[model samples]
Target: MRMSELSRRSGVSVPTIKYYLREGLLPAGRQLSATQAEYDENHLRRLRLIRALIGVRGLSVSTTREVLGALAEDTADTHRLLGLTLGAIQVAGETEPDSPEPAEVDALIEKLGWNVHGSAPARATLAETLASLRTLGSPLDWRVLLPYARLAEQTAVLDLDQLEGIEDPLEVAERALLLTVLLEPALMALRRMAQENESARRHADGTAD
Candidate 1:
């Protein structure tokens, strides 16, 4: 297909597609003539994957590049690549204007017995979140996150189980991308439903009191 057809099919603008081609996110099309090029199904699939990574996953260009590289590797370890991608998107907490100092973060890492690599963005994110929690007068403790972490681990296992026996690498990668993009909202809604049921049970018990 020509550029205009590709633009219509992929729902990506021509200039944006050109930018992606230039940035090496999307591969260059075949030169059919002096001023015309042609794209194929592979290009269409790649463009959609790039859109999902950037638009739905909210990954920065550099991070998305790293992820795409992993996906492209013949011997790439999917689990490890997913871990790194998730780490990049992890929300440590929130930050306040008068947030705690980096030194305080160092101290907290020590206090929590966390053996993090020396001074990284992850550490900074944690520090900022802790500071924000404090500013909001919320109880901030490592123990509080334990249950949530356990649930997250279980969910990861569930996601992997769902993906088991996918021999096709491209299909596996696409499924993984879609799962990550869609699962959070699904989990959140499930939690809300559970909360409502529990609240109803509590109200019934209170009425009996």
Candidate 2:
């Protein structure tokens, strides 16, 4: 496909596509002539991923470039690839943010026997959230979250199962990002429905799990 076709199919403007090409976010198309080039399926897939990274995730060009670098790496470590992509979504850096709940959060993760990185942004966010809950007069600690953590373990298994058997890193990363971020709203609604159902069941039986 031509760049114009890529632009049309991707809903990205031609100038923006060219800009991505120049910024290394999008790879160059095959040189057909002095002023013409042809793109293919890989390019189209990457274009969509770039759009998602910028439009949905709001990553800056440089950050998107870094993620694309991870995708293009020669290693077969899908774990590391997914980590970088998901970590970007969490706005993580090399270190956790300074907060009062750091130790508590670390202990909680250790108790759960999860292998999450120390610098994961979710860790810091959990710490900050605990403090906020205390300020709001509803202090819930990690012990209270233990059961929910077990549920989360199952949910994580289900989530990763969707990506099983994929070989294309670009496609895998794109699917992971879209599914994780885009499904959150629906996932929350499903949770609400389940909560209501469970409440009714417990009340009707006069017993709880």
- Please state every model's RMSD to the true fold in angstroms: 5.4, 4.0
Each candidate's lDDT (Cα)? Answer: 0.73, 0.84
**Whole-structure CA lDDT of model 2:** 0.84
Show model 1 residue runs off by greater than 4 Å: 1-5, 60-63, 66-75, 89-131, 167-174, 204-209
Candidate 2: give the clashing pairs.
Answer: none
In angstroms, the error of model 1 at 176 is 2.9
Clash counts for all predictions: 0, 0
Poorly placed runs, candidate 2 (over 4 Å)? 92-100, 199-209
Candidate 1 lDDT tens digits, 1-209 = 99999999989999999988888898889999998999998888788878877888887888777777766764267665555545556555545556554556666556555556663556768677667677678846655655665676688789888779986555566667788779878989999978877887877553322
Q: Can you write out model 2's per-residue Cα lDDT over 1-209, one digit (the tens) per residue? A: 99999999999999999999999898899999999999999999899999889988888999899888876883378898888788867853222356446777787888989999877888877777787777688978778988888998998898899999988888788888988888878889999988988887777764545
> What is the Å distance of residue 92 in model 1 from its true position?
5.6
